[model samples]
Target: MLTVDFDRLGVKPGDRAIDIGAGAGRHSFELYRRGADVTAFDRSADDMKAVAEMFAAMELEGEVPADARACAEVGDALELPYADETFDVVLISEVLEHVPQDVRAIEELTRVLKPGGVAAITVPRWFPEKICWALSDAYHEVEGGHIRIYKADELAAKLTAAGLTIRGRDHAHALHAPYWWLKCAVGVDNDDNVLTKAYHKLLVWDLMHKPWLTRSLESVLDPVMGKSVVFYVEKPVVPVAAR
Candidate 1:
């Protein structure tokens, strides 16, 4: 299931797109399928290796346009391995809350995006995540888990400070919020719990089939309790100072 909406992100054929902290290449694969020259960057070597293999598999399956290109690179989000103004689109989905220096990471993302380019950044919405934290210490206290919780305004302000203008914002994955609450209530690692297992099956079925009932329900619920909040922002064609 995708968090950031690519149509809203203004993806186009041949766009130079990068997915920063692309954990499982979900967005990167979508970008490639849409004919963008895609880069899937992450901090994990093993993840990147798997992503690269998937890219090749996709190519073999003719999943991407022949002209579209993709590669996976393992790197630090703090110091992106690209020159300034390099990518036409940038995505950092469900990643910022994990970073200790989120503002600095935002600066790095902003720096690499071409002027007038758009980006989609997402993070766990405050209340749902807060519930998870309250329910279980194991949820956010673990390594590589969330280091902080971002209030919507706080995150938007930081992006503005990095010279990005917020174009739009949205909330998504409303159904997943309750599932996480369930997990936190039981044990984050407890797949053995009957209720948790049942919920997982439901979620998996929803992902695979995407039947209309669940989709309609999610659409109605998304604005209320979406697990992730997405922000669409753009760099000004003329520098913000110039205007």
Candidate 2:
């Protein structure tokens, strides 16, 4: 399921967009469908390879706009390969928490974004993530797992310090919070637990079908129990005199 709201991010046709740390190209594929020139950049070679294959498959299937382009790149978040002011839009979803130098990663995001361009950043909400940490270390202690929790205000301050102005904010995936809590309770890695398995099935169904009941419930509960918090921001356009 997608975390960041593309509408809020202002992704338009022909926009140059990069999904930094794109795990499986969910956002990148969405961007392509919206007619963006998309780069699905990730540190994982295997994931990038799969994403590249999917890009080609989508092209063959005519899923994306005829003019839209998409490619997967193996890259580092802390040191993006593009030149400064490269992309019109950037998506950094569920990635910062895994990076030891989150600020540097944020800086890199800012650096690659064109002046006045927008970005959407998503992370696990503090309360639910805190509960996950309290219930099980295994949930976050593994390699590439979340290194630390981020309070909403702390994250905002960091982004502002890196020259992005916060434009909007929202929470998402309220129904998924309890599922994670269940996993943490039973055992973070225990896929065989009856409750966990049942919950996973329900979530899968919800994602695939998005029935009215769950959709309405999630809309109501999002403000309170949402698992992910999203922030939309813009890089300030530099004045000619300042330049």
Candidate 3:
């Protein structure tokens, strides 16, 4: 499911977009569909390979518009491969919490965005994430899972320090919060638990079909118990004199 709202992020056709730490190319795929020059980058070779295959499939199936381009790159988030100011838009969703040097990661993300370009960042919301951690140590204490919980103000301050101006912020995926709570309550990896399994099935169905009731409920609940917190920020454009 999409985390950051592309409309709020102001992504337009022909925009050069980078999805950093892209696990399965969800945002990148959407960008391509919207006629962006899209790059899906992640540290996992398998994910990159899968994303590339999907990009090829989309091209062959004519899923993306003619003007759009898409590619996958395997790379480290702390050090992106592209040169400075390379992208018009950058999306880093549910990624910074896993990085040890989160400040450096933000720096890398900021460094690659062009002047006046926007970045959409999403992280596990503080309350739900804190509840998950409190419910099960295994939820976040494990490798490659969330290493930190961020307050909205803390994240905003970090972005501001990195020279990005916050434009808007919101919460998303409220419907998914209970599913995670169920998992944490049962066991972090307990896929076979009856309740967890049932919840997973419901989540899968919701994602695929998006029934109206759940959609409406989530829209209302999203501002409160949403599992993810999204922030839209932009690099300031310097006038010639300021430059």
Candidate 4:
């Protein structure tokens, strides 16, 4: 499911965008459909391979605009392969919590974004994530699993320190919090729990149909218990005289 609001991010056709840690290429695929020159970057070669296949499939199916382009790159987020100011937009969602050197990755994000360009970043919201941790150690205690939970203001401060201006912030997937809590309570790996299974089915249905009742409910609940907190930030463009 999409987290960043592209309309708020002001992504338009021809924008050079990258989705860092693009696990399954969800956001990257959206970017191509929005007519962007998009790159899906991840450390996992297997994931990148899958993303490449999806990109080719999208192109073949005419799912993306004619002028749009997409590719996948496998790399470290702490050291993106591109040069300075290479992208008009950058996105990293649900990724930083897993990186031990998250600040370095943020700095790399600042370095690669063009002046005046925007980036959308998301992390698990503090309270909900805390609940998950409290409910079960297994929820996060695994290789490549979440290593930390972020408080919104703390994340904003880190971005500011990295020279990105915080433009906006919001919470998303409010309806998802309880479902995760249930899974954590029952067992992180146990889908056989009747209540958990029922909740999972409900979530899948909500994802597929997005009925108005659930949509409106989630909108109301997001600020209270949203699973993910999103930030929109911009790199300052120096005036000619200042430069």
Q: Which candidate is the best by lDDT?
A: 1
Q: In terms of TM-score, how similar is model 3 to the real structure?
A: 0.98
Candidate 2, residue 204: Cα displacement in angstroms equals 0.7
Models sorted by lDDT, best on top:
1, 4, 2, 3
lDDT of 3 by residue, 1-243 (tens): 899898888889899999999999899899898889999999999999999999999999999888889999999999898899999999999999999999999999999999999999999999999889989999987879888999999999999999999999999999899889989999988878999899888888999999999899999999999999999999999799977
lDDT of each model, Cα atoms only?
Answer: 0.96, 0.94, 0.93, 0.95
lDDT by residue for model 4 (1-243), tens: 899888998999999999999999889989999999999999999999999999999999999889999999999999898999999999999999999999999999999999999999999999999999999999999989999888899999999999999989999999899999999998999979999889889989999999999999999999999999999999999999998
Clashes of each: 0, 0, 0, 0
- lDDT by residue (48-86, candidate 1, tens digit) is 999999999999999999999999999999999899999
Question: TM-score, each model?
Answer: 0.98, 0.99, 0.98, 0.98
Q: Which prediction has more favorable lDDT, 3 or 4?
A: 4
Stretches of model 2 off by over 4 angstroms after superposition: none
Candidate 3, residue 127: lDDT:
94
RMSD of 1: 1.3
The TM-score of predicted model 2 comes to 0.99
lDDT (10s digit) by residue, model 2, range 1-243: 999887777789999999999999899999998999999999999999999999999999999889999999998999899999999999999998888899999999999999999999999999999999999999998988899899999999999999999999999999999999999999988879999999999999999999999999999999999999999999999999999
Worst 10 residues of 2 by lDDT: 2-11
Candidate that beats the other on TM-score, 1 or 2, i.e. the better one: 2
